[model samples]
Target: MASDLRTQDIQNPVDVAEYLFRRLHEVGVRSVHGLPGDYNLVALDYIPKAGLNWVGNCNELNAGYAADGYARVKGISAIVTTFGVGELSAVNAIAGAYSEYVPIVHIVGYPSTASQKNGMLLHHTLGNGDFNVFSKMSKEISCAVSLLNDQHEAATLIDNAIRECWLHSRPVYISLPSDMVQKKVDGDRLKTPLDLSFPKNDPEKEDYVVDVILKYLHAAQNPVVLVDACAIRHRALDETHEFIVKSGIPTFVAPMGKGAVNETLPNYGGVYAGDGSNKGVRERVEASDLVISIGAIKSDFNTAGFTYRISQLNTIDLHSYGTKVRYSEYPGVRMNGVLKKVTAKLGQLNVEKGPKPNNDIPDEEVKSPEPTITQAWFWPRLGQWLEKNDVVITETGTANFGIWETRFPADVTAISQVLWGSIGYATGSCQGAALAAKELGIKRTILFTGDGSFQLTAQEVSTMLRNKLNPIIFIICNKGYTIERYIHGWEDSYNDVQEWKYKELPYAFGAEKDSVLTYRVSTKKEVEELFLDREFASGDTQKLRFVELVMAWDDAPVALKSTAAAAAKTNAEN
Candidate 1:
């Protein structure tokens, strides 16, 4: 028997665009971000009618970034763009979503079915007349692709694409031809919510695996849990935290997993990215008898260029799809189910709370009490000032590296292009994140980005201002590509960037004087004063706040300096 969640025998016909937008709404996408072009303008017409907000981005690329940011907060997001030109422009952002396990639905408005069949030379199409090229390129980045023309298949195709996106935690593509906008299709699928849940393991196999894991758990004198990025992507944080609490195990997070677990947890160890980790964390994690890693993505940067010393022999790795108990692999096991079972079984064992881990920044390392603003001083101070549920989006360079040292408060979510490492992503994404946060009743959206990276997508700030969002943006003015300078050449002129008077950008971007707040901080006292200011600290929604923090060109976070040295050596060898 089919599930009752489906509409049994009733079939309602609705416009293809209506059905698509309604389905997206049913799945929690309240807004669709994109730029309108000739090909997609008609589809954009249905957006407001279907009760979805049309977030008019300045460009296709910024739309993609906004969609990614929204997806990170809202679990799923959609972006609409025109065919060749618009889609191609958003490809880099889509690629970042893929690399970082963000689920986004990329909807492209293509030429009409008749135009494609006749190979009509459309305004947006290449003169060569192949309309299939963009979809082919999108296939490389999207988990699922659906090119729709027939209304009969549109419902299933759209559902399938969304399912794949949800199941894989990655981006999917949907190409809607202009002719199919009003075609009547079955709206039956809209009654049934998407079943993105993973299949359960065989009961016997699951029990056997759990028992074996419990045996390992029982014998270990020192067991530790390492949380990684997938813990958030897989929606396994609750189970992960339960396991950690029940077992009383020491827990550490990877660089990519910064905000997944609450840093305020008693057993919480700091980030464990090899040498980049807090002092003594590496020793405790490496010396543990068993290290259970949940959804770990050991990207070079996350692991400090593969400097992790934990042996696979003593590691039990749990992922979205499977679980590996040291040498044995359970292919069908899901981390959600596996973690639940482990937490239950953990109650049967007498687990002792380990020594209290020291995850704090030492007083001696805080700052030189110097007048100059340094990363060590700035990051920790920012950490202290951060409130609960503040969403932090960091750019790919110095800001990204600097964020690793900052401890996130409870329910604080962090968004970044860590694996993709795309420069200038945060500025555009901050706009989307701020909007999403507003929609979800999250008050504060904070962005940290470097001067060079910020220049890449600075225009998105105009979009934020237009939307009346209040995101506190901190622009680190190092005056160059600081991360690149460390990676290849420390003194090379190629890494330098042109200076911008960032404090005046809000006014230059057409923001009304009272609607925005601007500040420049060159000294530690200034930064501290800004933190203490009610308007700055509380982030008054009436005004968008922008801060330019001036630092020496060569200054960088300690983690960035160390990882860059290793990265530089690796690049030289390659």
Candidate 2:
């Protein structure tokens, strides 16, 4: 039944913007986080009309961090802002996303063609140009950079940028000029659809590498596989689980990679960080003849300040970017190959059957038994309280340490910008994470953040209240910048911050005091009491529970020494 009808036409620019926004919506991006400015005015106007919410961020860095956190839960996220200042401020978060393999789309608005010819000093304009701005800052962090000059290029470039983000598991930048965003083009040209593909292990390379990996696996008396954050970002969870089960190898997750494989599995050892590492896990990792690190980044913090004295030769590094195979007496081979090659080879190894050590260690030896009342003490307890259905969001500072120290059960989800290391991220991120949790029907959304970080995006509490989200937020009240004090060797004034009545935040934000529980804990006993009481329960009324744990500003966690050492090493390298 072929029929011809008269078609109603809209301007090209409006149609292009609508098409791009629709695609983003199709991809599960609920909102775009950024600050509005002159260059991006048109797009900002088009956002609501296109049915996408605009999350107005206080600053660009926080906006980017929020987007990263959102992506961690939603599979993808986006941020939009103006030229130079906005873009530059967001570099830290974008770079962090790149390092951690978070898929995000960054849309920057540039000056129009007429303005460039004027040669006057424009807001957010560098002496150079918008192209140079994106070129220099976006090269390493973004998988692709597209300039929206021709209206015809809008759909294609936007689609390409989005595709690159999903393919590479990294951020991509798209620069939209003011003029192009308002100009019209043939709407018929915007019909190119997007294609989504899952990353596969290279079959050819797998055959060869698997052979090499199996040789070592068969010869080793004790072999273990270590999974890290990269495994989670690369969608290798099922593959990792299958490998663990088939190989029957003991598995341990790095601090960042916790919960990638089921923590409750018979062969699973808990996280390997500070107090979380059981004596059994430590011994197993040290005693292994071959240690296969799958998508692991052995950061000094995660590895006890690089104190795990593994012979460089006994290590096999399998990462998303590349692989490194080392031997005691020979130079190692670093190659760009698919993980399937090695996994398939290792699959053939004989399954070792026995009751292995549980890798649990006594509290005193594993960590200082004395309570420091710092964020570290809070994490393990929080981890224990968290259920598989819970989603934990951590802010920068002690909250990050909390995440580093905590162990999540198989279904528990966690999100943080560890690489970006931006302050105030967790506060706003909790909002986005909470929204995602609600959409996904996840119960018990929790946030652990520092007082300093909370101040950066405290306004989001209103958003949480308005949305009727039940998020239990624990604010570590050690004054301010606890992490910076350690990094800067206790630069007292710079690191110290003024105190606020932490428990009153929810009430100030118009939440019911009874429903929104608040606690002030100064000792370990207090912490135990509150957690055991379950004062911050979710029910008919959405709750905003705030737990203020008191500690000394200069009373750094033991892990700070490793951070300081790393800083020293970085300074020396520079």
Candidate 3:
């Protein structure tokens, strides 16, 4: 009474690729950004079949940036590339993701085991024929690395990498060898139901630290909460809003941590770092008696290059690793379990409303804004233009400014690969974002990018045309790398870029002439008219429009001077 059954088998490479692809889909990764190469042919073949969209980019760098952007909106994203050259090209974007703490999974294809054993200098082989070059590079970017050495390990490793990314809020690398992909494994052996839970602050020492913080807050006449990137990465947005509301403390978000709370909140103090920050933000921060920095890094950028005064006694630094009070006798406490414990204790105590600081500038002064092309001007204007339900994807350069400047409305959503300041990220990301938006029934998608960065992935314009997606792309044509110019003195040859007829790109990419539209403006008047026009829709073959604004390359955003000043002040203080 033995039963015989029909057995069906898939190629090893296809199986491995499909397994990983399905796993990604289950975890909410709908689109993958990448540059296809010979080494990754198997994965490429399986991508479309797995029901995941493959966003092809002009280069690996752009692909990485696009993935980073998608992650900013969706909380996590992935990038795929070939062995050596492809991985190396993506390093800049990956490093940016690391810096900003975006969750991106990088999948790199490698040479077969035979090639490694035979010591062939195959295509993309780094003289050693070892894939560790990518492993080491990824490690340098502070990302966790895993290799699919065995077929059985592929699913587990892929799951591990994704989990690690969610936990660490950083990029993770997975190297897939060519031959191992298609091998079969017990379907039950695959990881079951991946968890997205983040590591929390430790509870054991929470009572003591919470007591100390509460004591300081009660005694202080003025207190403030400084929100930073870690808060956003930890998905503590709601918790932060509740904490601020309960405490009745004014709040300031780090430049990289903007949109953590409603900007329209009564206690909102504005951005304290980067372009949109007010001139008096540092003074307000320094004047505070107690500063509670929740999930903030003590990095130079977030701390105004360490320029502003933070009494080691008054600072409470909270991070994933632990909690510490600077310049205090209190010992650092592990944070994994501390936040809940601290919140529980503090939740029991009655928080009293204190006198609010007069941080607002007078209407007259605020009206006569400073003459700078900073986030102050950019964000508010952009905010006004955005609809309640629209999705905003920011490229690295101007996008960083938008993070600091723009206020998130109730229905408006914002996304950027802040961790990876990869140029040319916004264009391809726009494609992914638009696709996702369409799938979700979101009508409008907008992209804000700089001219220099846009050129890096301009090829994706054709992809948009092919998909028939209508996304309004705003190219800030300053004609150079403005961020670099601010960090290091501008070198004309290095920072300057040739001006492009940006509005013409759509037509060059086979977009229907009537369906595509172009707008070039230098003044505010023209910007208002073109930005508000309702005719710019996907169906209007006459509407594949590109708007180019002529801005000065030397025009530093608002935060640049403040940052420089803060650095100088820190140097003097030190």
Candidate 4:
């Protein structure tokens, strides 16, 4: 990869900011998300110099959210903000990343080292003269924190922070002092890139765990492989897929694990969220003699409000950190190596004769005289309409629960926050996801979000249009927070939202008249016709597509109704 472009020589020195950003670029961060501020302005200069684009966000929170989406797609992402006000605004997003295991590098530009040490009155500060307050608040959520206050250890500190962020697959904090931005650091260190490889699991233990799993796997009359969020977040899909394909066992996923398994495979079943499962899927999964769960998170939403009837005595849980067979715990027995060994050592299994799992989408109703769109009809229909390799993002409301009913195409990437149910996240995340897809030359990036939640970060569409990122945005105009109403206050006005001309947004966002396509579909017929349109449904990634899909405000998906009821019972409100 050497070139005559006269890149920073290994023998020479590079500025601390340059070292930090170059390391980010090395790990596939093509764009840095954040807002420009006085303290961070100079450090932002190094972004482009280090072969990265500066994605200026309208707000700090959206920047962090955008970074989360970018990391979900690109493996890792970074964001730069000012010392106090900016970093604090982004703390919620960073916390969300930490909760959901999204790797993001949160870089904060501080006042000069001298000013911080001498307690100079800084505008962004809390005026208490305690400069470390914000970083201290962030330390709880971040796996590692690096304060680049000194030039001597800047390079090493930066490398450590980035490594921890990637290794844990969580957010990390790196505070860069304004004065230290240009401080010289050894550029030779960059020649030998950060050791980003994961430590190998002890082979003996991994194989032993694999044997235990296989013992049950072989004896079971009926077995099912359950893939979940950690399977993807922990980067174990390669091994999981190998085991699923090799074992030929019926495979299913938790809601958070949607898109983890390829639905095109005969062995691949639909989602299994306890009572919220796809028709026969629940009965089939629960009836299995042994349930092989991989990186599964049994969260409230993930397990249909923890209604998983599968017996712990019949389940073997394989996780990133450890393995659990029945009730016996095998701590430190990671799944990646164990699954790989299982797949390699596996022989013919006695797969009990049973009805094969099917993700059958119901035929559209042609006799609906009123042609009203319902959640049940929309979700399953979406399964039929989705194409391969598309990146689909769902917001934390109805769109999130509704998407569980849909089956994804092969290699399709599904992004949503089930663990951290943040309302406004998808819009900002879509902006980042679309840009990431664009950078990878992917044809389409689609987003489904409630109009209420979209309003929280609606301005992010402007950011997408400004960057010329073409994402198909579906703003489910259900009038208000339907999910919230379903959970509590069904008739309360607080659950309502103000309406907007969502379809006209592209034009208002400065997109060229012909550069974007807008649609407002109220009836089932309109939706069917829109999906059937060759230009709209085809892989026409050239134009931005925004759709306003109107639905009944009181309506919710079957999963949402049950999940919300369970949630309400578990946590009583005032």
Error of 1 at 243 (Å): 1.2
The regions of model 3 sitting more than 4 angstroms off are 1-14, 189-191, 199-202, 274-276, 300-305, 328-379, 393-399, 402-406, 411-425, 432-443, 482-494, 536-545, 552-554, 564-574
Count of residue pairs whose backbone atoms collide, per candidate? 0, 4, 28, 0
For candidate 1, write residues 1-574 as lDDT tens digits: 3433333443686788998898888788998999998888889999988899988998988899989999998999999999999999999999999999999999999999999999888787778889999999999999999999776678889889988888898999999999989887767667778887777777887888788888998888888889999999978989998888777788888989989888878788778899888667888888888988999999888988778999998999999878899989999888888889978877554343443433244476553566888777677777888999999999987788887777777889999888888888999899889999999999999999999998889989999988999999999998889999988878888888889998788888899889988999999889879989998878445689999989989888888888888888887784
* Model 1 vs truth, CA RMSD: 3.4
Candidate 3 lDDT score at position 429: 72
TM-scores, one per candidate? 0.96, 0.84, 0.83, 0.96
The model with the greatest lDDT is 4
Q: Over the stretch 357-454, how does candidate 4's per-residue lDDT look in tens digits?
A: 43354554444455788887888788888889899999987888888878777999999999998889999999999889889877889999999999
Error of 3 at 227 (Å): 0.6
Q: What would the per-residue lDDT of candidate 2 be over residues 1-574, giving only the tens digit for each residue?
A: 1111111243433455666677788788878888888888887887876678887766787777778877888888889988887888888878888988889899888888667656657766766534465556788789898877766567778788888888678999888778767655445544555677654445665555556677778888888778888888876666777778768788887767765777667787655543335435666677778877777766655664456656658887776555666742111222223344455555456444323423232365347756556544555666676677677887656666546555566677777665556688787778777777777778777888888888878877776776677788888888788777766647677676678887887788788756676788887778777777744554223566777878766665455556555655765674
Give candidate 1 misplaced runs (Cα > 4 Å): 1-11, 348-369
Ranking by lDDT: 4, 1, 2, 3
Q: lDDT for every model?
A: 0.86, 0.70, 0.69, 0.89
Model 1 accuracy (lDDT, Cα): 0.86
Q: How close is candidate 4 to the true structure, as a TM-score?
A: 0.96
- Pairs clashing in candidate 4? none
Lowest-lDDT window of 10 residues in candidate 4? 1-10
